[model samples]
Target: MATVEQNVSEFRGIIFLVRILFHADIYREALLSRLIILTLFSYFFQNDWSQAVTKFYRTPLLYERSYLNFLYLQNKFSSTKKYKKVTHCLFDLDGTILDSEIIYHKAIQKICERYGKTYTKKLQNQLYGVTDRQLSIGVVSALKLPISVDDFEKQMTELVQKNLTDSPFKEGAERLLWHLSTSKIPIALVTNSTDQAVQMHAKARPKLFSLFHHKVCITDPEVKRGKPEPDMYLLGAARFTPKANPTQCLVFEDSVVGVEAAVRAKMQVVMVPDYRIDKELTLKATIVLKSLLDLDPTLFGIPAFKDGVKRGS
Candidate 1:
């Protein structure tokens, strides 16, 4: 009996050792694979590995896949983190939440016409969701028009004020705003529009402005860089409570640039197409709805609807 027990103990110890070795082997391989990838990438992309590591660490990833991988690793093993609760909706005005696209185009059209430059569909599409400075710079570059940034900004501001005063809301915008307000889900206006433009548009249309008011996150020239830079969205995220994880907020946008910004911020987004800007927005947006009015309780995961009030009816 004693010899049999000794044999059994030896077998159990051997099994335990083997299991440990197996786990160690898997871990080692994973580490080695990552190292090999990093080494190869550094070698091909940069001549010096040490210099590459330093430069890479200092800068943000330029590729979407790499950024996604970084986010995955960040969320996987992080301790003492409270996930964000989805209580806020970040809206893009002009195009997404309101029907001010015509006003914007008209303003640009008038300016372009003054300079003997045409505002074509192709050009407008290229300008969607770009920063005010970027848009002005681009138009100036394209038309070879002699316009300073300051002068262009002032002119655009005047034109926007003149054109947007009576701008109408997009279908279902009022209802959406009323519902969101009643629900007490905080709504912040995140726009690439300058603060002056935001004020002008808001003054022209109070209903839209009121929905955004203390909740506004305007693209100020002062604080951070513009969209595609991730600064504005990061600022929005920072304004919320520490627990307001990017996952909790919903970004409503209408342009590819807007979608890219929200994606980098790790927020979910709904895209309302800017028909004028016919970019392939479906690729980046989480949900590409035909109209904002189409959004219902079911869309937001509010499952309290009775059969009588079926969604999309």
Candidate 2:
């Protein structure tokens, strides 16, 4: 006869084998049942089986307790659609919705030459989306220019006017603006450009400017700070709601500082970055687009742009 240890070892091995066989049978039966159900459904419903099954199994009793999760989610999300929360569209000037980057590049180059300094793309990026005084001081510091800040500002202001124009619109930018205006979504223009430059650009591209319910520029005496400081973005929000909860608006920008400022203001931002703004910096933005033209009504949670549009005269 086998010893106690030997018998126990044999018994354990047999039990393990039996357990494995039982599991194998259960799995095989489950698979077979699933296949049979699928075959029957397919034979009757053809391509529509999935939809039919989904509709049929929508009841809680047909599924596990966890299946009710989506129902709760649906209810949770449905309430948001009931009330149309005022959505404001905040636009950045310069390289964003406008093709003002090239003009600014030339303007900065002229300022650098006047001050006996060289302007690099990196330096321009650092200064981009900043106000005239702020840009002058920042550029002078970054380039180690010998010129006084006052002189630098004067030269840049002159050069910017000479070089800048509203010639070509960013792809879909005009269309998106039109859609937003028609949808009755209040829009506001926010930029670090001086009041003069902002006005000129707006005059040239009235389609975009006209869409905005309010326009906030760095030139405004009340606006003491610029991008990366959150002042301009906050000012833009005030245009729509004085107590503008940044959470209610969507900001569109093309620079790192712009996105940072929008984030600081607690607003949703979409970045359409240029060569100067890095992808990493734009990560703070809610959405990053190749261009403003890429925006659609669905982005604002609307079913369609045409559906919501209230034509403006």
The C-alpha RMSD in Å for every predicted model, in order, reads 16.1, 18.7
Write model 1 residue lDDT over 1-313, tens digit each, in one string.
3477655654543353333334333453344234335644674575553454344443333322233332223222232343334667787777776677788778888888888888887777888778767878877777777787678767877887776756777776666766677777767777877677677766766765686534434456544666776667666765654435667778888788888888888887777665443322344666555567555444555333233433231
- Candidate 2 per-residue lDDT, tens place, 196-311, comes to 88778777766668777888887788788778888888888876754466777788888888889988998877777763343235546665656564444464564465534333
- Residue 141's lDDT within candidate 2 is 81
